[model samples]
Target chain A: MPFTSIRELLPKKDLVGFAILALIIIVLMPLFLDIFRLNLIGKYLTYAFVAVGLVLCWGYGGILSLGQGVFFGLGGYCMAMFLKLEASSPEATAIQSTPGIPDFMDWNQLTELPWFWEPFHSFTFTLFATIAVPVLFAFIIAYAMFKRRVGGVYFAIITQAIAAILTILIIGQQGYTGGVNGITDLRTLHGWDIRTDSAKYILYFISAFLLFACLFAAQYIRKSKLGRILVAMREREDRVRFSGYDVANFKIFIFCAAAAISAIGGAMFTLQVGFMSPSFVGIVPSIEMVIFAAVGGRLSILGAVYGTFVVNWAKTSFSESFPELWLFAMGALFIGVVMAFPNGLAGLYQSYIQPWLKTFINSMLSKYQQYIPAKFGLGKPAQEAAK
Target chain B: MTTTHNHKHKEMALYIEGLTVSFDGFKAVNDLSLYVEEQEIRVIIGPNGAGKTTVLDLICGRTKATSGSIKFKGKELTRLKEHEIVHAGVGRKFQNPSIYEDLTVFENLEISYPRGRNVWGALIFRRDDEVRKKVHEIAEMIFLGDKLDSPADLLSHGQKQWLEIGMLLIQDPELLMLDEPVAGMSVSERKQTAALLQRITKDRSVLVIEHDMQFVEDIADRVTVLHQGKVLSEGSMERVKSDPKVVEVYLGH
Candidate 1:
């Protein structure tokens, strides 16, 4: 009787319905947005990818890996490198209305592309590089840290340092790496006309689908025993180990997956936005990733995507709409959500909609039963008996 | 193999031959050899520096043996990782309360619920009616059938300990190792825990490290006194209690 009743309170089936609803909303977004609006939404969805990765590593795994932006930048730079290379051939360069190097890189006196920049001229290689680069970086770092048993604030410090160092290194290498300006002047991907409305719409839809994929995969993992193990590792690594699980392997797995997700987001982002900069890999963006996951609700995957969308929407709408007062609005929003809705939008849904719908449905069912008796002329007899 | 284990019992469930565990340069557990038999509740009593916890560490694979072999059920346990040791039927509970506090009592059990000990199978584990029935059956055995709906943190110290033991039991390890199981408990609670341990050892071996002599005397099938990283004396509770060395070491007589 204990679990029999307790099990009924669980939301497993209702959660599926919500996921289906989310998918429908995502699939139909392009129907409403124009090319320009779709491009903007695609950019937002790309950032949602970074948020999804953050939720996996920092939220679920208890690894505050601030260097996700380093992987993000790595992936973005790899894609930007390809786009820039494709833009820079003498025949290709002559066809561009503006110089491929831009006026600034040309002023830096760079005539040819760097050696590492050569192979990325092909789209296939850049796409491969995007996922591979982050996975490789995550593998090395997680192997060293988790194996050595370095945890707590030490993990945070080390990952943050990686991002800080990457940003500085990129900035210091001005010409080949583009320094602070960061290898811009990207015009197209795979020689396609990026300015075309249909092409841009297709990109937005691709981003939406990919976001759904990442979100679904993340939710599946969380619902699975792996998520529980990762949470167990976060709370007590020694206990999970004592329970007969390799805690480090779980950490490395989630960390690498997160890095790969961030990398994909970065690649998608640079392609859609036409720029990559050292600022993208800096400490601020790294902090923003954690804040989004925390403020959104780290436990839920939808919370991660939703958090990213809300934070970014605030940044886009309020910041752009208000300009100078954007930072204050964002701060207020963070404080408000953390104080009022500690579990993020997911908490809001649980508190407001879940019980209400249940009760409403129960009422409707009873009314239907009452109406059926009347339809058969049984209601009058029943009412008279009750009186 | 220059090392020779000098213990009399050859049929020991746990046999440590020349086991040495050191952190940095200091040896926490010296080249110490010990043996534990099946279904015996062996209480390891020791002073602050006696390395009682460290011995548990070396046995459970939390701390590596510098140059030694740890054998469990006649299998060399030195190369096995922590999870592998547990899979090999060695369960360890830490000195601290390590139960998942945020999750419900049932959820804590569900998280620790056994399903063939493979990641793939565990990942795909859904609500199998049989597994649920078995879990509830185990819950009833530990007297936690009524408390399953409560969050883990809401349980009393004794209940939490029982819940942790229950979590280990569903996996059904052959050897259950606990560090300070009754470190904090009332008289009735300690008695209840003692009864639970007695019930458990019917099918599994228990190694408990406790500072409370009364709690140890109530449950320990045998007592092994550790002094400065070595076994000072080990025998039946009455035998160890009356030994001159134990009196001298513990009571300063």
Candidate 2:
């Protein structure tokens, strides 16, 4: 009868945090940045989607998947395949020996399209495959590992190995995939030129909206009893199992969900950046994505978004000026974060900032309450406490 | 090789037969059989490696038995999974007070409320009056009424033990299996726990594995002494104390 479900989904503190983040992305960035800068921010935001999922999968569920880049790459590749097929029209490739196949296929001396690329010709199938493929991969890994009770560091190593394997497979298969360079030169989606400035601006908003939608969903999960059980399982899995919950199923569910979310981000990355590459589907980027979640406050969805943006911004600036110091700086950031703030920025905010802000707000409210009683012509015998 | 079956067709809470388990080549529990009647408190006493804990493990589906049949209320349980075993009205508590330490005492109990066991059920579960009332009742019973908001890890070792019992109680399981519930508890805490167990066993059965002799005498309706993975003696507390075999294997050891 308490309507706790509604309150849990949109708690006051989280509502404020959500509002501030939404305002920064939707209202401030568009007004301030040019099309080029905004599009870059949009690309960074796509990674935020993966970080958000990591917060759920790694932070809450205690599943450290080091192959998230695999899912992201899978999504990006799915979209890239569709876009590449569209870009490789018979009229566009009339000069090539084979007019219909992708240019990379021409370079690799293949006259026919690969079997896998045939499905992406339909936008509908490509759309579904973008999410489904990554989730299916995640399900296989989760089901096998969780069912056998293989977790902790072993799970991390296996996933990282999978990331390494995927990168090699993508790079080695030069004919079907674009090899080291990856699938690039994507031009349009349903005949709309994605490279145009207007389209870039529109895509940035769409990406921001999708990120917030993911944030809302992640928040809902964290507030529910399922989230608490995940936390419990992370701490003591056997206890949860004896409490009448299938621990493996929960693990599989969260892992697949994380994969699906990361895949969505990957697809959006292709739409904005106009390419899908093996560069994004390797161990390095996958671990980097985890750090984005870690630095943001792995437990906080909104924090992961900010974490991704700030880290990427720093990476861009550092690499631009002092490329040599960038790796060292990144390494130190990770070490410093782990040593000083295990919970990251959100933990710091909760511990040091939130309490002070709460008292400040309470004092302001108490003063306002005195004025309210006076305005109503009621005697202020006892001052009401600001909760 | 005999099951030592007691009340074969009665409304027994648990019945295990020929439950053998081996770790590599060494037998942890060999050809073990156990029974608990409805609304009874059965305590298992044993030396260090007498398979007291292993029997509980087999019943709760933690450790798979080599060849056995476990039945609770005439339903086969050995084939069921751990969660399924719990859903079939059996709850287990580990030796080292395995409550969720990061969560508050209320949340620790709330998770075991038995209604929302599945993923979807948990997502839609609301803390309505019924849930709140039940949690409060269990908290009071466990003497944790004043510490509902306190984190479970912050409580003393004895309090954590009680909280674990309260968690099991929230599920309203027909059979409760506890391993060393008073292993690290204070003498006073042990007495309080003994009283708490007495009150809760009015309508349910409890299978306890304990080492404290005085504590055992206070709560156990029947005592089973185990040694070398087999039952050496079993009867009333006084009857088992007088048995030379039980004294040699358990009391002397």
Candidate 3:
């Protein structure tokens, strides 16, 4: 029954878009790219998760959270802590001052591991903590701000402040969080060797699949009545309120949901990339995530994945050759995106490419109308009308 | 489901007593007391800054009252939030048309259907037969039947006003508050709106803040004349127009 109504859930345009994105991610990318490049794409796909979340929370909900990297970092740090603990087991770190403690703790002359790190020793606890920590943090922030009706630029500024504070706290407290270098030397996840190229390939597929799942969830949200209400609230909040909708609760829900989705990506980043760092937890990366959403057309869910890929790919290639010019080029890309195509690549495609594709397909169908008979189950009913 | 709004034996659908809202030093609505009986079309007319719209704002929870008791069907509305007030069967339309411009006329009406208002409820809500029937029913009521699929931004000023009214009608509120429902309307549109208001107010009480005297005379079952944030006269339109204080404050030089 549910599958029968699934067609009504998404429009034909969105269904086509989802199918195309699925093909590229699940089939074409893995087949075409080598292991090394596939790993790089895996890393980029992690950011795509954040971008998809931003599309729901920011684009549709009119919430500009410039600190999504905070949730991402929290999730990553949770997973990284567990992996680091596994790597620095008593048998593994026997030469260290504290055999069972993490190397960073031992290096900083710590005699014992912290109490909070105790639960992280359990993989199950760490797995749940990865999503739970970020979700709880996001819930607290969203509830307080939205309940008080502090929104728009104020919300963005507060979120950015949180990102900055988390980064500073992480870097300043070296022993607990691996300080500036972050939790490195991550070797295994429950005795499975993750540093191998085969593991990287497997992890890439996992990451891509998870990213696509998040995209589907976001697409569902975008096509739902909740999505329309979000757009209505974004445009005229007072009107929505008078329409008997609890506007703040909706805002809080979307914000928290976005946080959870982004957290999953963060966990995947740690698993695939083998480390978590404060470098990805600060203002710069947080703003860059928003750019990924914006460059894809903030309203387009699948466009976010493509946007992240395009931007990150350009960043990687350009930085390798002209490292100094990469920042300038990135700045130009943002400016060009805003000034030229305010709706991003998706908007450009919708305006120019989609109509042409429709016309081209229609023309071809009509041109072949004479060749295919009505009995062949093709062509417009005009051919049948003639018969 | 509606809020626990009990009509009881109370004659008034809406009852406001000693309602006062002071912004800084000046009181926008000063000790204003008004009542609209069930199914009554109560029109409020006043000079500029007479707290006409402020009364609606307070009753609808848009503006907090400095001191007052606003009761709707015997339920206290002072502490309720805007949406809570709406669920209690009070719907408000602003002086400016407030329909979602990006949405179609049908979409606008469907949103105000008083169901699936929660975050999760809206996500799973289908445009089923019931919702479609209600949306079309409202579209026809507002004379927007032919333009149900057209985006609301394409509507004229009068049509937008009707669209907003239609949006409220979809909610099926027991107490409908319309602020300047005919302000930007043409003569024919104003007449149409008057007829529309009369038709809609058959079962529900309507509180209209109208400026046009002719429009007021056409639709008002009773009139409350306000001056300097206080009621100057209260009677039928003919009686209020005849009141010397009302004429001095509202119509005289």
Candidate 4:
């Protein structure tokens, strides 16, 4: 039964998509690109985590959360706190009055380690907190809103407000949170120096590995009965409710799951980029993350990764030359994508490329039929020729 | 008015008293009391805005009653959530066909199968033989057995209506409420649906709100007619149809 379900989850087409993505991320990208470029791609891949979550929450579940950056920021901060503490060992901070505490806290004035920062000293706790903190926060927000039946545009606006408020709060509490600059200069992970090129390569691989793990998990969920329920709830909330499923509970669960995934991405971002900041947790970045999912084909999980890559690649190249026009270009791109191809790149592929590819492959196989052995399942042509 | 006794309460599948729901001071369902017997098929018929649908909404927990108690199989449903009401063995079909158009016909039924309703349960819910068999059974009953893989959006309006009925059937609720099950159906489709309802409602209590008097008379064991959010007449179909007040407000138009 499990084997059948596994097969069902990864059918031929989806398996091919997964394989192609794997080839690009694990084998091709690392082989071709220099470490610097690879590291940049790795950073973009972190955002793909959030996009993947959005695929489930927004694309399939019909939830459009504009506050994902808050979860990402929380996850990043959790990891950063641990890294920041390791970097701020008493011996390293002997120059400051508060030798054991973080530099920002020391700079703020005389102080011991705050209550929240103390647990982060344990790497195990930090790892758990990275996913848990964001999920818990998401649960609170989802519970409050969904219970009251707040959704659609109102939900989106509320999530955007949360992103804004969280950013402001982080920025306002500069002393404890590292303020507008965010927790910075993260030097090591568990006594190993992270600044070396080798570390960057290793971190990139780790991020890729985690991304695939997330992809598989998302794929599994997408195939599950719950996935259909999400779709059902999306189309008709009342119908699902009358079907004896708590619609709000499903919404809350998916929202929290999305948050946990985004938080994972945020933690990876901090590790790869060596900083955690309010800049990534604000409304703009949150909306940008949504664009990543949208352009990828909100309906497609694999599309989310490709979407993140394409959009980020464009942003990098375009912003380098015309930094002022990048935002306008992004706005235009979003509008054009929505107006022309509402499903994004994935939808375009499904509608046009996939069929073309199928026919092309069939024709090529037929052309090469004589050369192939009968044993290779191209036997149909060989048998026809024999007849 | 029937006096409430313990033995009588035990036989009742649904019992509503003083049910009133007001939207901005305009009472949609005003001080209405209704009782549905176990295995009885009760139909509510009225003109537009007579609040036939509102009664179903209140019982199904879609609309909060301004003042009332709805007891489903001895459980109070007015204070319950929609899903909670469903869990207590009440299923509701909306005015329009509300099946998930994005999914397959098989998927629509599978979702309505009574199992793994919670978050973790749904995540780990497997499409084992039991689910598959039940879905196939319901599909066959709905006459979509051959079209199980077909997307629901492609189903005709009548088929969509049956698919929604099939969805509710899979739940096997003790009390099923359908609003205008054959509103847009063709005459033959309406007859087929009436037959479908008769077969499916053997053991369960059905409270249906329908406009077509023929369909209602074909299936309804008893009919309740409403006027201005109040019950105008209640009895067998012939008795309710012959009532002067019921004819004056409803059939006379």
DockQ of each: 0.40, 0.64, 0.59, 0.68
Using DockQ, give the best candidate's number. 4
lDDT of 2 at A92: 97
Candidate 3 residue lDDT tens string, A1-387: 112277776776778898898899878989999988889989999999999999999989999999999989999999999999999989999999789888999999889998999999999999899989999999999999999999999999999999999999999999888999999999998899999999998899899888878877887787778888998999999999999999999998899889989999999999999999999999989989998988998988888888999999889988999999987888788888989888898998899999888677667767887787767665753444346
Native contacts present in candidate 1, fraction: 0.52
Q: Of 1 and 3, which scores higher on DockQ?
A: 3
Superior by TM-score: candidate 2 or candidate 3: 3
Winner of 1 and 3 under TM-score: 3
**Sliding window of 10 residues with minimal summed lDDT for model 4 chain B:** B1-10
Encode model 1's per-residue lDDT on B1-253: one tens digit a residue: 1112332443468887888878897888777888887766788987788899999988888787898888999878889888888889998888877888767777778767766345565556675687778779879977899988888899988788888888888778889898998777788877878878777777677899998888888788778898877788888787888888888887453
Candidate 3 docking classification:
medium
Descending-TM-score candidate ranking: 4, 3, 2, 1
Supply the DockQ value of model 1. 0.40
Clashing pairs for predicted structure model 4, backbone only: A174-A179
Say which prediction, candidate 2 or candidate 3, comes out ahead on DockQ: 2
- For candidate 4, write residues A1-387 as lDDT tens digits: 223655688997899899999999999999999999999999999999999999999998999999899999999999999999999999999999879889999999948988988899999999999999999999999999999999999999999999999999999998889999999999999888888899999999999999999998899888888899999999998899989989899999999989999999999999999999999999989989999998999999999999999999999999999999998988888888878888999999999999888777767777887788767786463344446
**TM-score of each candidate?**
0.83, 0.95, 0.95, 0.95
lDDT for each residue of candidate 2 in A1-387, tens digit (9 for 90 to 100): 213466657976788898889899999999999998999999999999999999999999999999899999999999999999999999999989989999999999999998999999999999999999999999999999999999999999999999999999999999999999999999999999999999999899889988888887888788878889999999999999999999999999899989999999999999999999999999989989998998998888888998999899999998999999987888899888978999999999899998888677667666576566566633332243322
